[model samples]
Structure formats: C-alpha cells, structure tokens
Target: MSGKPKLHYFNGRGRMEPIRWLLAAAGVEFEESYLEKKEDLTKLQKDGSLLFQQVPMVEIDGMKLVQTRAIANYIATKIDMYVEGMFDLNELLMMYVIQPADKKEEYFANMMDKAENRYFPAFEKVLKDHGKDFLVGNQLSRADVQLLEVILMAEEYNPSILAKFPLLQSFKARISNIPTIKKFLQPGSQRKPRTTEEDVARAMKIFRS
Candidate 1:
C-alpha cells in the first residue's frame, strides 16, 4: 500500500513468479523474503503470518494475501478469465519443470504437445481476432502480463516455439520491449531464472519435509 510490497516465497519461481511479473509489468518495485530452509517456513507458521499456513503470500496494502488466485486478483483487479487461462498454462509448465530427471523428456514432450496444440493456439486466436497487441483491450492488463510470462516459459523449453504463431511472436516482442518489463528481463533482476534440478530438489525438501 504505502510502501513497496514485500513478497514471501521460495527463491525460485512457483506461483509467486506470476505475481512478480504482474508487479514488474506495472512498474512496482517490491522486496522478497525467500524461504531457504524448513525453519524459515516453520517460523512464519508459528508467528501466524500465514493465514492459511501456506505461501505464495504477499504483504500489500497492509494485508497478508495468500492463495495464488487471490493474490493475482488483488494485484490485477480485473481480467480474471484470461489470467486463469494463462495460469493454467503456467501450472502445466511447472509440472514439467519439477518432473523427475529421468521422466523429464517424456513430460516435456507431452506438455509441449498440449501447449502447441491447445494452449498457444487459443491465445494466438485471441490476439488475431482482436487484432490488438494485448489479449484484452488495447492497453496492457494482467492477462497480457501473465500471457507474456507463459510465453517466455514455453520458449525456454523450445526457443522456436513461437515460429508457427506470428501473432504471438509479435506479442512477445511487443511486451518484452516495454520499459519496465525490459528492465525486469535483464540479468540480475528480481525476476527468477528458469527453475533448475537443484532448485526443484531444494523446494521439495522444504515443502515435503
């Protein structure tokens, strides 16, 4: 609210990544408190900082927001439908990212097939049908920010994923070039890098233990 929002989550991106994306896209600077160890989470729970005793929480507007959808809604008041769709895509990608190393290849293939055939085409059509740079109205919205995040995640797996979709390619280019988003995309920015095997293992140890 008055001061910069503080985010509480793991160092790597999970649900909080999209919230970071939205805030960055809006040009809002925030701080992060990463849960690096089990005690870090246990402390929060003991202190009652977590309403649901779970994370992806945000301290904004003098309130502690939990639940990914609720936090996203608070950040981006409108544009639920598109945000939900993009988040659905994000979850699919997350599933692949955290898969076992031996099973990653198969999961990656299945996830790509769904993304290319089902998800990407739907968003591509929304852009083409509207003939606008953003998925919703002429200006950027939460939908646009979330979609851009999803597109980048997809491209990390396949650099040429957008080759078949010219509109999405242009959309990604347009969104990435925005001054705030451009800054966030830079190296060393708060934006987390693609999750790695070590990151996944660490997260599992923290949450599953």
Candidate 2:
C-alpha cells in the first residue's frame, strides 16, 4: 500500500466508507489507517499533519487531502469516475439532504432533523429519476458511494428507509461486492459496525432535545 496514496479514518464506518470504497473500486491500493480511542486520535493528530479538520484524509505521495467530498472527487477525477454533470448533481444532492437550517452551524444541528421523513424522498427521487444501476451511467462513481453512506446512516433510524429505492440498494450491493471493498467488510480489518451505531446513538442523544 506504500506505493499508493493513504487514507486516514476512524475505525467506524462514518463518512469515510464510501470514499474508501471508491478508491478500492478503482483497483488502486491505498493506506487505510483506522483510528480509534483517545490515543489513536492523538497519534493521528501528531503524525497526520491534517490538511483539514476531518477524517478520511488522503495522503498521496505525502500530500494530504481532507473533506469527504473532496477526497471522493479527487480519487474519482484521478480514475475518471465522474459522469457528465454528475459532479454538480451530486453536490446538489448532498445539499438537499443536509439542508443546513443554519448555514453557520449546519453540520452540528442539521443531522438531528434528518431523522424525520423530510429528505428521503428527495434522495429516492434523485436515484429513481437518474436510474437504479448508478447515479449516472453504467459505471460506479463517487456519487453512488456517497449516497450509500447516506443510506447506511439513514438505516440507523430506520432500516426500511431506503427499501423503496431499488437502484440505491443495487448501488450499495455493487460497491460491497468489489474485491477490495469486500475485504474491508470482514470483521477484523476495521471496527465492528455495532460500535459505530453506538456512536451515532450517543451523538443523536445530544440532538434528541
């Protein structure tokens, strides 16, 4: 993996999952360093030289990149994974879901409201109108994976949340089926998903008010 770029993320699935799958699907080797606990966090802070205050940072030949979307886009661009207008369309999709009630504090307060029935239809509509096989054409792209992350997160609140969207399910299956991605699905490569669920619950407890 030293020969290729490296990606740093907490052991939980979180936002990094889709981007990691994107790089793997490209058949490109990358360093998938899983961080957990206070020490792991401190060590990453020490050695990571973070370009952004985010996990899923990619270091290509020692250059660091941050932001889940940016990381996805960078890998997508390197492998030409983006579709026509998909780049912009995907951004629009993200904004539609997050729907910052307060642009200044969007990331902090936005997710609390998402547990309701507000945005799922928007996503389903986009996936349905765009077709099920992918968000764009036949090949998988960053948009597909990002949507997968959203779907997975939504599952925390309701497993049936995305059941209506067959294409999105197909897209999730497609990424999970990849050889490299499949490997990460095994129990040991990363932290157990149940732990991530716990983290989500703890975060939501604060927003539950």
Candidate 3:
C-alpha cells in the first residue's frame, strides 16, 4: 500500500479488532472509516467496495480486502501454526462476548474451562519449552501478538486466570511491554474497549436494518 491501510468497520470492536492488534504489533499506523449507520454499509455495497457485502474490509496495496482471516493473513504474510491456534482461542472469546445475557453464564463457564485447560496450557508449554520471549521464534511475530491479545481478553473474563500459568503470566507481561504494542495499549490509541451490550444492540440495528 502506498499509504496507510484504511479499515472499514463499526466503531466498536468486532472481527476488525484483531486486525488492529496485528497492525499495531507490526508498528503500522492505519486509518479507519467506521460505519455508523446502515446507510454507510449500504453505500459501500452500492459502490462495490465490499466484495462479499461485509464490513471489516480494508483498502490497502491497491486492493480491497474482506474476510477477517484473509485480511490478517495478508497483513501477517505468513501465519504461524501457533498464531492460527491463538485465533481459534480469539473466536471462542468473541462467541462468549456476543452471547445473549441469559446464556452468558453457561457459555462463560464452558469457555473458561476450555481456555484454562486446553488453550492456555498449550501456549504456556510453548513458551516454557522454547525458553524465549516469543512463542515461535527469537523475535516477535503474529503469534506473539495474537497470544497477547487473547491473554488480555481471557483476563478480562477472569482477572486471576493467569495465576495458574506462571509462564503465561510472564509472557503477557513481556509481550505487552513491547514499545509498539505498549503504545497501542495506551489511552486514545486505536484499540477498542471491551464489547458492551449497547455495542451488540447497535450492531444488531445496523445489520438488521
């Protein structure tokens, strides 16, 4: 891309949020065009901006990209296996976030069980076995960013979730302190807040309209 990539999505975090995390981790500054109303999305469709009539689209490198995975893959160029696993964890978290209030308790319990037992342990072992600051290599990669994002998300659900996994606790501390990511973590950065019930209602109105 000649200029900074321009992202199209709602104001709140959704599938696009991870793309923001990845770009920030890579130290890239980008622009966003939030769809504040249904007409905003309709106009994009009318103009053929969306190939599949979806948001979370990006304008970059003389191309319009859609599909969350495709956008992340293009940004990452080559995704590590560990990065893919971390994305799976992110999806599980997103599912819980968007669940109906009545269903959230059961969903949260199940998600936490899988995260603590299945997901967190696997990445903890990766960090421990490698004995490095990053998961896949000596340097940072999408895997590291993805892991950090998920760790924060998991912690938002349970502040003490990482207590059992000391290595992951250290990993979170280490990756989050990186200068680029650290900047993104600061207030007034492009990073979005945790999804709220109002966000879900707003999104429902936008898409259903």
Best by TM-score: 1
lDDT of 3 at 192: 96
lDDT computed for candidate 1: 0.89
- Residue-pair clashes per candidate, as listed? 1, 0, 0
lDDT tens digits, residue span 69-172, model 3: 89999998565678778888888988786788799999999999989999999998988899998887699888888889999998899999998999998888
Model 2: clashing residue pairs?
none
Which residue runs of candidate 1 sit more than 4 Å off their true CA positions? none
Ranking by lDDT: 1, 3, 2
| Clash-forming residue pairs, model 1 | 1-61
Work out the TM-score per prediction. 0.96, 0.58, 0.95
Error of 3 at 146 (Å): 0.7
lDDT of 1 by residue, 84-164 (tens): 778788999987866777998998888899889988999899998998878887898999988889999999989999889
Candidate 3 has an lDDT of 0.89
Candidate 2 off by > 4 Å: 33-48, 52-56, 77-116, 178-180, 191-209
lDDT, residue 183, model 3: 98
Q: Every model's Cα RMSD, please?
A: 1.2, 7.5, 1.3
Model 3, residue 87: C-alpha shift (Å): 1.9
Q: Write down the lDDT of every candidate, Cα atoms only.
A: 0.89, 0.57, 0.89
